[model samples]
Target: MANRWIRPEVYPLFAAVGVVVGICGMQLVRNICINPDVRVSKEKRSSAVLENSAEGERYAEHALRKFVRNKKPQIMPSVNTFFSDSNRD
Candidate 1:
């Protein structure tokens, strides 16, 4: 008996739909990575010029230091256990 539920003619349609869906998924991921929210916030903050007063200068310095610290990649020590030395390459 022939499989009537999934006929040969519908294969092309399924393939086209799959391609379109895959393209859409890839575009979404690209959009998320290429256009991030952190950049927007950075731009907004940059436009706001800090005051020359001592308080404003101090605040700006603190903010700059915090930003640098946060952006730096954290290096964590490897796990320590009796059975394994995780630090070994």
Candidate 2:
């Protein structure tokens, strides 16, 4: 009966939405537990601010930038090692 509304063609769309929602859920959970500024207690929630303060600098960085900020683009980690003999072990 339920199969009448559901189709195989819609499976990919469901998978994509599930992935997106899962990523967002994980991010939210991570922020709540790890970020100092994210107040779990009701009393502290009033004082919470979205913008970065002095200490908030660490937590305020966007997810993409936080990872990519210090990371230099490397086509492959072993590319240079493979080409260079002096550095090879």
CA shift of 29, model 2, Å: 0.2
Where does model 2 exceed 4 Å of error?
42-57, 60-67, 70-89
CA lDDT, candidate 1, residue 55: 47
Stretches of candidate 1 off by over 4 Å are 37-89
For candidate 2, the lDDT comes to 0.78
Candidates in order: C-alpha RMSD to true structure: 12.8, 6.4
- Separately for all candidates shown, the number of backbone clashes (residues 3 or more apart, or on different chains) is 0, 0
Model 2 agreement with the true structure over 21-54: per-residue lDDT tens digits:
9999998998888687778888878874655465
lDDT of 1 at 24: 100
lDDT to native, each model: 0.60, 0.78
Instruction: Put down candidate 1 lDDT per residue, 9-78, tens digits, no spaces.
Output: 9999989999999999987775554433223455555755544467445534665597777553534433
